[model samples]
Target: MAKFTGDTAKKILANEINVQTLLHQHPEYQEEVLRELSIMKGSYDLKRIQAMMNKYTSSAKLAGNLIYKSGFNEKTVNTFLPNIIKARMALHLLEHASIAASAQSPTKNVRFNLWDGMVLQRLLFSKGFERKPVSLGLFNFCWKFVLNKKILMPLVNQKGIYCFYSKALIRELIRLIGDKKCLEIAAGDGTLTRFLNDAHARCKATDDYSWEHYITYPDFVEQADAKAALFKYTPEVVLCSWPVPQNTYEKHVFKTSSVKLYIVIGTRNPAFTGDFGAYNEAEQFTMELNERLSSLILPPSNENAVYIFRRKEH
Candidate 1:
């Protein structure tokens, strides 16, 4: 493994070093970079991360106290909002550093420090505030809390970070999808379908289980690709969450004869998710943002949208 100096870590953090190119040339180098950033005691990068944790600690405490005292009422909301923002900023610093070191080699985990674990545990799985699979309250808590993004974005590989499904989004979808059989393709973990089923919506979850490294495919999520699921289920409404950017599979959704309404939960940023080319080329459908559903997609800061595609009335 190549020795990653403090200067090298600094260069990576500054975007001076082309990590992608470096990784392409020497894939083993990524491990070294991750080690230096996360494991090397007294390293500059580690110190920077520790400093950010300190800031996050102070801010989270202040925000948590305000919420505890006033129950996050209107008057207390504004007062603690600044502290929440500060916490987010502090966590972002760690996120940036983790991404800078590990994005190129995505399969390798970004190990968080001891302090990071405590902060993240409180943010994700705190008692009395535990929102099991998905909830608007949970999403709001995560969005308002800084440590949420830090723990989620950095600790895991890219495959782990999918769209956060909110109860509001699911409820809105249930209303829009009334009477229509819905199917979710690429259904990682099958959590969404579990929620939808609980809401009594007729939706089946299916996936090829390709991302098994990070995603746990429940038995409810039938093992199949997008094309296979669409053909077998033959649902009227097809749903997908964060389809791989510019992937070939999603075009199959447009081709399926029974799919009249296709809903995609993803970022508007074309480079981030979904195949815009397929969406544009699929002339038989009229695609537009479902404004109400879009607003319901959780965490608020993720800037995700719920896109609706209806077969044109020919």
Candidate 2:
């Protein structure tokens, strides 16, 4: 990480410098951001948080080449997601500091634009990213208007080390269980799938495409429901990130004969991710909280957890 001075930090906060410069220099810039954010109570320099994330996400795709260039199963680098997650969570709380704030009834207008799709495709072929830590630097930049929770909160959540953490966890998983096909169901953007694929993990991504309005589903991702994907791919290892609560497709994974193990990346909040209903109801598999894998979840929250379900044939 580069030595960032208070003056340099101020300039970054003001957008005088490119966010990529900061991200490349310091992957763990989130902590500095939060520390500085304490003093930026009424400022709005964070307006560009959305645009910066757009570029960061694109850069993440480019970083895959670097990651792939590293030897297979090699842990190339660490990500700032733990700090980033905490910073974003704090930023969100800061954005809604007032008790009078109320949730807006979500409308159909919730959607992504062409930029989302455009960059996603470009990301697939992009390369030659800088050789340094990539940080979103949302907190690093100063703002221009009063922070708008409605517009910025989603980007803060959507953004961050989406492409980085998966590489670490998946490599660990495949290292544990070698010589098996892997399938990622409910793969929202296929970010994890792409990294794992690049790392030589025989993994393919599939999603039901229900969040098309919210996500620009990558061309690499097969547009199929989880159960159908399990049947079609017949993978031995199954993984999913943030599967919707009460979803049934994951339940069908166990029904498939080829699936020997299932892995889930989700929140500690019981109702936030994956299918607790299915995990609790099933009798054929042994479930355990995978601390090592879960510990790698971005933002490193108590809410993040990874579960491994190994089948026990009767």
Candidate 3:
């Protein structure tokens, strides 16, 4: 790793060199560059993220209060937000690093010490603030608190609290999916993908790398949109969560012959998340609202539901 001083760090932070070229020319410096990038000013707005969570979720008020009371003036917020932003970017950077490092050294472990995690890890485990997995139960607590805490924790710590889909849900998915390959699309930050992989599920994640504000495209997540990923991976099972409202890409999942099961986690209220239109119109598969598979997630408004689609039998 190149030793970067104050001047060089500032220059690097200012985007003085094209990041793409820098990475290509000095792949060894990717991790250091990413660390600098996190310190540089970034575009993530905690208020915006919090607003979305506040509007859509209700799971962690006690935790939220702890964050809101953290005495942040303008300067503090400015400096603090970058650290939070770094945590988000590290999501991609660490993944790419793992892949690069692993090729040369299989045990290569890339861990992050994030700024945000330091402020919020303790609060996540506080009582009266557990996240509910079922959709309808999502609205009962402050999900904004939990989500921000989660995003921030990664900024400061390598090991912290993690939420996953319930074991029963994972087991059911595994049982139905069997030994088939699985793919998750638009896998924001890949929390669920990690959960699946931890359980030894034959799952991989792909994304179009659209959320540039929060992350750089990770090498591990194949940088393809839904259609392209479907064609390339040709997975038998597809997974997605809260797809863009009125999304267009999910339709491509069913169009592929290799896909037999599509698992979606979103609201049952159905204001058009995950190409529900395509699922409704398609005749080849049957859709069911799975209550049993809704464990171990933040339902946000107690309205979260997992829609499971299976190919029709002859």
Candidate 4:
């Protein structure tokens, strides 16, 4: 019998080893039994993963190997590994009643909406699993997956400020706003604005008062009431991120003078406009704006719904 060393125990707890195979080979221990034992006998839990990750000089190399061995393609592995590791650790912690109870206590908790579809979309695309089983499964289980804070904490931390911008999406946005003063309407937390700012474009960020929980930058951030600021700024390029509210104010930005570009980042589904209760008005607004603006640009990525409009040169 192969004796389980601390290293072996750590690997087992990480799901690096097949639990069923371990149990089948060692009938004396049940699968769960082996998992728990591994945790107890080795520093194979959340803290261990974090500590070992620092010690490894080549974390990326090890990550690649793990992804390959786990039967995920490069993209899916890159996208999902950080979140998966975080989720796994969370589950481990939750399995302990004391920790779980403390986490559930109302006094220790506050409110924040987890980043849902966006995070999943990035993970799926990164792992090259955008078309794979894992991606499909993630889509199906998205609600449950993101509902837990533990899974999202690592992703929020890993991606830092640009967690919202997929590399491809950012590139596309940068290309569209080339050498232009850009305005991100409904720029929650200035995520997109930050990206544009980093790309060296002149950009301003704005959001409705409701998004106070998410919007962090005061200098760039402004209340979304268009009349209050639109004519004052006169942006050459205007951008809206997904879940854009179907409001007259959004349409008004398009009407503002000297606005050369209007970009809407969302689903192509005309239904998305209506489904969110802003459909009828937004559709009418889009039609009127389309008549005024020329040269529309749309990308084919199913994950992101993007629409770009260029003002007709007078």
| Predicted model with the maximum lDDT | 1
Taking all chains together, the TM-score of candidate 4 against the true structure is 0.41
Q: Candidate 4 — worst ten consecutive residues by lDDT sum?
A: 291-300
Highest TM-score scorer: 1
Better of 1 and 4 by TM-score: 1
What lDDT would each prediction earn against the true structure?
0.63, 0.55, 0.54, 0.47
Model 1: which ten-residue window has the lowest total lDDT? 10-19
Query: What shift in Å separates residue 284 of candidate 1 from its native position after superposition?
Result: 1.0
Over the stretch 1-314, how does candidate 1's per-residue lDDT look in tens digits?
23334344333323333323455555453444445345434333544564555555566567657755765465455555434434433343344443344334343355555665554455444243222345666556555545334445434435454445566777788887898999999887776677788889999999876566556666778988787778888999998887755444688899999999999998786645677878999899999987777777644544677899999887
- What are the clash counts of all predictions, listed in order? 0, 11, 26, 8
> Candidates' TM-scores?
0.58, 0.52, 0.50, 0.41
- The parts of candidate 2 lying over 4 Å away from their true place are 1-153, 158-167
* Residue 240 displacement in candidate 1 (angstroms): 0.3
lDDT by residue for model 3 (55-134), tens: 32222223223333654333433333333223333433433332222133222243224533332333332222222222
**Rank by TM-score, descending?**
1, 2, 3, 4
TM-score of 2: 0.52
- 286 in model 4: Cα distance from truth in Å? 9.7
lDDT at residue 84 of model 2 (Cα atoms): 31
lDDT ranking of the models: 1, 2, 3, 4
